[model samples]
Target: MTEANGTTELPKTCKAGVVVNEGPDFTVAVEDVPVPTPGPNDLLIKLNATGICYSDIHYMLNDLPMGSMSSYGVRSPGHEGAGVVVALGSNVTTWKVGDRAGIKPVYDCCFACELCWSGRESYCDAAPQIGLNFPGSYQQYVLSPARYTQRIPDGVDDFVAGPIMCSGSTIYCSLKEAGLRAGSWAVFPGAGGGVGHMGVQIAKAMGMRVVGIDGGEEKRELCMKLGCEAFVDFTKVEDVAAEVVRICDGKGAHGVFVTASSAPAYASAPGMLRISGKIMCIGIPPIGTAFAGADPLLLIGKNLTFSGTKVGSLLDTARALEFAARGQLKPIYEVFPVAKLPEAVAKLRSGKVAGRLVVDFNA
Candidate 1:
């Protein structure tokens, strides 16, 4: 059992990636910082790894329409993290030392809201995101709320669990919202990307036939290895949507899960869905950019539904973790040590990475 601030024999400082510019030209600097103490409802976690989400890139660039990370008083930017509990706060009991755990995009949500009560806490209007509001998992240690923290299961490795906390879980919720059954054709616009790759695996595990659309041969190979039934190389295909429609038996896919930020992905999504099909969105396009094809006439004519999810509820994370454990949602990430986080960030920003990039803090 841990006692208040002295919870465990912990070091005063730990290595972390600090955002220097805090804006579009931001860069990360590896520095030593004081380890944060857990509050009454929090747990101090010693993170082993964190996933480099595209959202992290957005936070560092201040690209979101919302206020800057500086406005939120956050410097380090990250969300998907997996580690073990090191200490517990005065009121924390749901977790203990050595218990594997993970953090998600949402650090904490107003649990009293109707959304939270209905198990949709990820959409809480006042929720403070991990990398934005609180110090993110880019550090060696982070504070996680007892209620918001995820319990990483024994079978799921930390490397896989990290991304599962955010990207994996986000797509998992999208799959659920899609309500796709076995043998249904599901189209993933960016099937080789982080969220899309996980979505491919999850959709497959759910028995859905997947048609993955992306650019380049590398992405196509990754999608196929991850169990996508059909891989569509958008860069080579004359008409990606038309090809997807053909792959789905001439009408359209049962659903189109858009996990790519490209405007064309959203614009062409409506054409890839079957009658009564839904578009489950998890990607964030550039600020001020709207889904151009959201014409009510088209939606009404096709009986298509448009719904989206941000991160995901804790339950959603749990389900995704299970999928990873079952070898259904395997990660296709390039692992980098914490010291190389800046390089990982740069590579992701440059669009050179075919899948997710994970940072290992212990290194």
Candidate 2:
């Protein structure tokens, strides 16, 4: 691990990753590739930590938007990234070498577009995802557009801030869009999984009462530890949705944030929403999958608003990290070495992982 002439050379080809095919047969391999070079406005980050996200598994399973999947073809998978800036392109100014920066889901965005101007670059019509379209952080080092990488605060550990870049930020944005007030009740469908766990803690930190819905004793214990006001084990409950409604005093939740990709969980959303309530869709419902829940007329009658939210902007990402820095929110994580990605992904696919999974570069 030596640096010379601004080249971080370990071997001629350092460890890197790629997606090799289609469907479950599609595999993520950790062969080596030439180290990437920084372009103008790009900063080369020597990644210390990266998170395995559900979206990565979705892409490997061929579960992305059909148009984008076909148009972009397959690429290496990764996005929740945290690292130290090792080198910067000549044109980069906002950051300097040694700055702790995060390469988020958003790699390059049309910064001049209306969405970006409004601080929603994650939703930029011309946005290109990191691990999705471009080569992402599943490598020795990653090159990121300086404009899109947010700097992590000095007090925050990179491992803790890694999930905040993507999964944590997505839930944060969804909660913001839901517009729940202090003391309002919000139900998170998959409240014990990686994203749902973070959302439960964040919702509690915002002073909202959180109802967690997930199964098993481990998840139930974790949800309770994360400050959830109620935990409904879907496996044990007679009616999961009704349990959520009961928790909200029969008025239903002020809002229900669907963090689980299960169709049945999504189908239960309308029943859990109070009158004039909102439903925020944060999880990507299963690929090639569709839902026909709650009628259109019922939406009008309940005055409910259904919305889709992407990850937050760079500013929002900074705020999310701040929550972690101040100890107001915590990202529970299971650490694994970079070489063990498949095992980590398998745990996630099996729905057994309780919190986020982080790949350790220095392990």
Candidate 3:
């Protein structure tokens, strides 16, 4: 179904991993869904791969205080997507058919907002999230605004580019905002997970020494291979913070990036930092389940600061992709076919995935 204009004919319906039940006991089942038409300013994307993130689990479980996906009638939950533009909206002149594009967490934001103008568009309250409010990447064919869609560079593959859309870019922005100088010790609390592993590589690529904290031998090996100077297994250690402090020249880490959503990880973060060191919060625990803070006396005594960041802006995502293109940031991931998407989601929910898990839509 090829046309003279090089546009491939789109199918009337396509496969999708729809959420069976929108609750804590939910399951994702593959189903046939109708392909949506692009708006005047949108591009119809045919996704090739999408990465499974823990945030997807949170959306399905409906644990976060944020509204549930079902409220907005969004059944599929995913954000990291890489694909080709199969059809272009009549008003879209910047992109053409067959161009490579990527979809991130923030689907669209109000360009008139102050946050959007200040390079923090991800925080714009008026913006709609991909998996939360809109149909997400789990669907085979998705519509993306031509202005916000990311252009995939020549050297980076779709598999690596997929996770970079969210996990990689998010951590890169966190490390950048921490403002730690090169050679400074940067510690990642969940160094073996999808976001933590990317932080390790990005931190190393920026010339910072990375010390990873996680459990199990598989994660240790993975972290070490990905450029972690030291891997601390929390399961075997009596005091995880003490080990991190001891590794950083007996002082403490310059910056501690909390990537694990567990409450204990946030509780022990301050104990792993030196005087004037900072804690950059990236993982979001369920509301009222955990809090990250230190005593006012300890904060004043040590001159410590705490900060947090969400997904990166368009500029940050571009810089992260540049790092990948230059062979600096390499994403460690396992690929699964579309039929095994449910299994992949279950594995991610269990918290045993050493690296990212990607689902290939065309496989």
Candidate 4:
């Protein structure tokens, strides 16, 4: 129960989607877990929605060479979480109970690190990941460090804000690193998936012309609706690279943003770019199974640049939220009840999801 003054009657136990097995063959089960208390500099947040990301699948499969979530004794796997703060830590005076908050991929990083000071805190070695090294938002009641929490604006819905915490901000960071200005040609491979769709919107909002590459009519419609100037259906096109080059005025895209983990996406990216074009790598393919590179001659001749980025810093997330609040970025997502989290995870694993899939705890 919540009082008018924002005081909450804390619950002893809350519903959570706990991982049944922590390996390749794993499942999510709904269970009652003990509610976590806020630390001296933390806040107790009651999550309304959490977006499912492919990174969660990697953590559960124990792949990616990043170690297993079990190493940290974490069961629930989720990072994009939007909710309301129900309690504040004793030492936290910046946030109040009932304030809207969201948790990002990086739970906390050492503030004194060089990377943290240089606007690259997401790569800080001392950072603990939200779902990997800490109990994540799959638990209804979770604790968040007040310093790293994102303040959700009043107009943005939870479903839209949740995915922005990760997918939206991640692609936004990659786009910023690409350094493409307005009217530049931005190509998005796998442009209809969770992260890719958000990239389409953000790039379009930034005044860049977007070309989306994916298979099927559904994704084509989505990309077109989201402001893609051109779309290539790989399933129907005999040569995806040729199609992308043709669409980009016969020169090729200014930047290729690879948001799909498929190896083919990486292999075909360089060919779809013009001279001096850049490749912004966002998706993680299976460890050691894939790589993105071009021959020395091609790299030197074309002067192409390859850059990779992890999640975004707090500033990047704030800017992403501003886009959402200003009606420029709207994330497309499907909602699932907490009990059907397993079904949602399976759908995402199938690689057919058009946009993001979010699980609602209060549903």
TM-score for each predicted model, relative to the true structure: 0.96, 0.94, 0.98, 0.97
* TM-score-best of 1 and 2: 1
Query: Model 3, 310-338: lDDT tens per residue?
Result: 99999899898999999988888999899
The numbered model that scores best in lDDT is 3
Please give, for residues 238-340, the per-residue lDDT of candidate 2 as tens digits.
8887888888988899989888888888888888888999888888866657573579888988898888888898888888888898898789999988788
Q: In candidate 2, residue 86 scores what lDDT? A: 79
User: What's the count of clashing pairs in each model shown?
Assistant: 0, 0, 0, 0
Residue 279 error, candidate 4, Å: 0.3
lDDT at 77, model 4: 82
Better of 1 and 4 by lDDT: 4
In the range 331-352, model 4's lDDT, one tens digit per residue, is 9999999999989999999998
Error of 1 at 305 (Å): 1.4
Better of 1 and 4 by TM-score: 4
Candidate 1 similarity to native, TM-score: 0.96
Model 3 spans with C-alpha error above 4 angstroms:
1-7
Q: Which scores better on lDDT, 1 or 3?
A: 3
Which residues of candidate 1, in runs, are more than 4 Å off?
A: 1-8, 290-292
Backbone clash pairs for candidate 2 read none
Better of 2 and 3 by TM-score: 3
